[model samples]
Target: MTRVVVHAGFHKTGTSTVQHALAQNRDALAPHLRIHLREDFDPLTASARSWSVTRSDKHFAAIGRNALRFFRSIGREDTRPVLMSSEDLCGHMPGRNGIAAYDAAPDILRVIADNARHWFGPALDLVIYFSTRAPDPWLRSTWWQNLRSTRLTKDLDPYADDLPRAADLSAVVDAVRAAVTAQVVTAPLEDSAARPEGPLAPLLDLTDVPADVRAALGIPPPVNAQPDLGMAEVLLALNRSGLDDEALSDAKRTIRRLAVKRSNLSPHA
Candidate 1:
């Protein structure tokens, strides 16, 4: 029987770094585990995100149907443990579309658990893992992300004040535990970032990828890091400028390019 580990997430918690490492080391880890990331579950992730906004039963049902279809397509004869990671599996990050918390996560995860049990049977070993970060940093990072990607005009302080409950990620995890029968595990970004493998340490540990292979795999530099303070301030200003959408996008692109150049030339970088 194959063991399945799903790293559903609380975002701004180094998920991109872990996913990057896994993708970079795919061939090296192939013998011990099979890896799946967000791209492999387009329909499921789409439905999950849709349900996050609409909260319609039909969209919710689509989540279960898509999940089962994805699982069924996997090769049954491959006994190697499967590790799938996607922050979207839970739902949209809080602050997106006025979402205050991962309130829908338990139900979404329950659907996933039910479908997995039905397809993989009683003998299947299923584990759900959540990667979390300290509240202050998580909130700040998430705020910056939204400012960059969306037209969010609020600065970090106000954003944090408005979405206080989003920081209580443990409560979200507890809800998931209550909703699903599979073992639930959590890793703090503070602890995992200090390890030799950086953010990927917890996941590599779970998949039991050999030490030699781990050492040999190329670890990429941090992925999707928040822009520096100066850049962040500029992004906030641009967001509030009320420039036309196309002009706003053009200005942001210019600023981002400059930020990258500055970062690459910095002594710390």
Candidate 2:
């Protein structure tokens, strides 16, 4: 039976780094395992996100249809192990669209698993992997990310204190387990970051990518890292500023450029 792994994410947990490494080594890994990243599964992810907000049966049904379509496109005849990674597969990050937790995750995962079973046969080995981080750091990083892209005006301390149970990644994983029968696995970002392949290490292990191919695969430096607290404070101020949309965009671009240059020059960076 073919094995299918889905790295559905808990955001701000080094997900971007994993996706980047996969894209970089796609050619090398192709013979051993087929890889599908967020872009490859956009339609399914979009429907998942929409369903997360609306909680409508219509949107929920769309997720299952999209999953079926994706599997059909890939063809069930090919028996190679397949891996699909997308943070949005579970739903939006907690802070977005007034979402407090991955409340819809169990249902969302059930939809995907049911569709995969229907397409790949009931005997297919399906696994769901969630990359998680410690609560304090995850909340801070999530806040900084929102501050950068969304007009979130809250500072780190308040944001951290105000966060709901979503901060507890273990609970989220438990919820997923309760709702689906697929084998569930988790890799803590802290543990994965210490390995040679960085955040991609745990996944490579799970997929059993050939040892030689693993050695040959390029390990990408961290991508989408959160800025330091100092930089985050500046971003918070920008979000609170009275600038209009166009002006705010230009100002944020300038600030981000400066932050990136500073990060590049830092010895620790």
Encode model 2's per-residue lDDT on 1-269: one tens digit a residue.
Answer: 87899999988998988988899899989888899998898999999999999999999999999999998777666767899999999988888688888898999999999989988886589999999999999998899888878889987787877776879999999999999979999999999999889989888888888788888878878888866648777877888999887888899788777877877632222
Colliding pairs, model 1: none
Q: What is the lDDT of every predicted structure here? A: 0.87, 0.87
Off by over 4 Å in 1: 265-269
lDDT of 1 at 222: 76
List TM-scores for all candidates, in order. 0.95, 0.95
**Candidate 1 residue-pair clash tally:** 0
With a 3 Å backbone cut-off (N, CA, C), the pairs that clash in candidate 2 are none
